[model samples]
Target chain A: MIEVKDLHFAYGSNPHDTLRGLTFHIDDGEVFGFLGPSGAGKSTTQKILIGILNRYRGTVSVNGLNLQNLNSDFYESIGVAFETPNLYTKFTALENLEFFAQFYGSGTRDPMQLLTAVGLEEDAHTRVRNFSKGMKVRLNFCRSLLNNPKLIFLDEPTAGLDPVNLRKLEALILKEKSRGSTICITTHDMHVADTLCDRVAFIVDGEIRLIDSPRELKLQHGERFLDLEYRDGTSLICTSISMDKLGTNEIFQKILYKYHIETIHSREASLEDVFVKTTGRSLQ
Target chain B: MRLLAALKQDILFQFRHGFYYVYAVLTVLYIITLRLLPETLVYPTLTIILFTDICTLGFTFIGAIVLLERGQNLTESLFVTPLRLHEYLLAKILSFLLLSFASAFFVMLGASVGGHDRMWFVYGAIFSALIYTLFGLVFAARARHVNDYFVKSLGIGLAISLPILAYLRLFDTPLFYVFPTRATLILLDVLDHDYALSEKLFSVASLFIWFLVLSGWVYQRFDKYVRHPA
Candidate 1:
């Protein structure tokens, strides 16, 4: 769905390129994540892909068309939800959707239906200026779906939302994925990345440090042992057992038969841990 | 059809932003002031009003509107859709031009001004507003906020008025024909009844040429800002 080769971009006043020789591709109908901290070029990469920022030196093709050569019709097939949740503040929620809905060709989703999907049906007539931050974020998501887009770009999609609303948005995104839509998200939220992304690229300082499925990353970076906690007398005993050939090991059999096991958990690293270990930088 | 929707949205946005309300009050105040003036004073005063206030209002108003959009990060949102850069520019110019022309018309009608000369207010408003609105786009491109835009726009604001010196003939502007204000002055000088035919032809031609040339410049500048913001 998208491809980038040696993409480099620098603001006019800046002396250094914000994106420096990065390369990656997202497959069709895949949920891809661009994971990075602030100023790590994730947003810049998304902007370049969406044709919002065109002065980059690179070969970027989206849906088989060069990013630099993309016409407005290219946008007709894609949707973008900005990190800042931009809407016409003076216009009501319904008005905002109706206004943007007109920009697309036929096959666009109904504005009211989209609002209802985000649980915003009651506030459809409320001016955006009166919305809380979470409401605005939901409305921003609604606008992205107005085009019934085949490829979607979402930046910080779950920011400023309570767990219920956040889950609602994530479900909506998954539903879009079920419809065979390509999804690319740039975010610092690890759970969203771990659960929603089929693959993730960990970027730092304008470079991709690692790219892999979250599960693979965790296993590759995690310790190859099990954390065994058992009861001995009235006290808890903790011990580590190697993951390899544990069933035939005598100590494991002795611990399994002699002591009551309280808990036995494999020492698998979390996605955040793998990110920090691989990238040498925190997601903060 | 898309462009028309955008135009309507822009007009509605502008109206909701209190632009129409502000102009309504200004129009009423100017009308009352023009009616109280002597007949000899009406046209000359109207000429100055069209040249300075109504025609140049786009230069002032567009800055605020664009700055506000940038504040909300709405420019980024708008550009990501199917709207082309030129379409956005045209919508902005046409929307504010409508406001400028309407305000000029109502003020003239309320003032009881008539004759073919009064139609110059309509033409002058259009030509002058287009020129200033493009200037507003150029200035707003790099501005961080409304206050920052005002601070940066003052220089060009004063620069465009340079032709007023030549208009009064206090100093000869050998390059007056090149100035946008030069065309604006010639168009707005309907009250003088002394503008030569060549000058009238020059004003219309200069405005048309300026619109074409300045449009390309503004499009590239705005495109640059959107692509790699300063």
Candidate 2:
């Protein structure tokens, strides 16, 4: 759904490029995450893809059209939720959605339904200025879904939300995936990336250090042993054993047959660990 | 159809913002003040009030709205939508024009001013308001905050309207005709007299030309701001 090659952007005559020869493609219906620290060109790259920022030095094609050549019709097929809540503070939640929905010619979902989906049904009539940060974030996400867009760009979509709302939002995003929508999210939240993304690109200083699925990356970078915890009288014993040939190993069989095992967990690397190892920098 | 929808939305938003209410109260106050003026002073007083409120104040109102939208990041979001720049600009101009006309009409009605061409008065007020509103867009586009906008708008308002005051014989100079405000002042001047066709045509032509030039400049500046905002 999106293709970018050799993309280079510098803000207003700055000698350093914000995005340096970045190349990546997002498949249709895939949830692609651009993972990076703050000011790591993640938002800039998303902005270019969404047609908000032009004058870059490379080809960016969304839905098969060059970003520079696309017009207002381009917006009809895509939706964007910016990092900051760019909402009308004075307007009610429903009013803000309705006002923006008028700009789309057709295929707009009902504003109230979207609000309800985000658990904002009760605050539909409340002015946005009175909403908390989490409420505004939910409303912002709701606004992006108004057009029922084919491609969605969400920047830090789960920021400032409590666990319940976060889970609700993640479910809604998964629902969008089920509907075959192409979703691209830019965030530093590793857990969100691991849970929601089909593939993630670890970016630092405008460069992609690594790109792979979270599961695949973890498996590749994780230790090859499993840690076993067992109870022995009043003490707990923890031991590690390699996975290879464990079925026929006498020590593993004897431990399992003789002692009660409390927990056995594989020493798998997390997405955050892989990201820090690969990029040589933290996601923060 | 989209333009109309956007226009409706903008108008509704402005009403909810209490812009119309505040202007309504001020319009009534101006009308009451005009009503107490002596019969001999009523015509010039009406002209002055319309010029100040509709023309000068219209600029400030448009500037404030634009700056407020910028602060709220509305302009950034609007830029990504299907709304064209000209449609957005026209919606703002037309909405403000309607409010300014209402103010002018109520002031005229309350003052009971007679012996003037009503159509000419309406046209003058609209053209003046358009010119000033366009000027406001230019200033608002460059301003970073309300205080910056206020300072710049004050300077621009003074520079433009000072010529109108001079043409009204607050100060004497034929040189004042060189400014665009001359066209508006001449339109107001023709209201109280049975002016010659040539003089009326000249004022209309001048105001139309000013409108075209100012609209072009405003659109160019506004488009640049939308594409590459500082």
Candidate maximizing DockQ = 1
TM-score of chain B of each: 0.93, 0.93
Give each prediction's DockQ, rounded to 2 decimals.
0.64, 0.59
- State model 1's lDDT: 0.87
Residues forming the 10-long window of minimal summed lDDT in candidate 2 chain B: B221-230
Q: Each model's TM-score, in the order given? A: 0.94, 0.95
lDDT of 1 by residue, A1-284 (tens): 79899999887668898989999999999999999899899998998888888888989998789987888888898999989999999999999999888888767888999999999999999999999999999999999989989999999999999999999999999999999999999999899999899999998999888889999988988998989999989999999999899889898899999999999999989999998888889999
The numbered model that scores best in lDDT is: 1
Q: Per-candidate TM-score, first chain only?
A: 0.94, 0.98
Two-chain DockQ for model 1: 0.64
The CAPRI classification for model 1 reads as: medium
Encode model 2's per-residue lDDT on A1-284: one tens digit a residue: 78999999988768889999999999999999999999999999998888777879989998789988978878887888988888989889999999889889777999999999999999999999999999999999998888888899999999999999999999999999999999999999998999999999999999988889999999999988889999888889999999889898788898899999999999889999998889899877
Instruction: Supply candidate 2's per-residue lDDT for B140.
Output: 88
Per-residue lDDT tens digits of candidate 2, residues B1-230? Answer: 76897788778878878899988898889878878888777777777777788777888888888888888888877777777888888998898888887877777777777555766656777888888888888888888888898897887678767676565667857666656677677677566656677866776777888889989988888876664452
Q: Candidate 2: TM-score?
A: 0.95
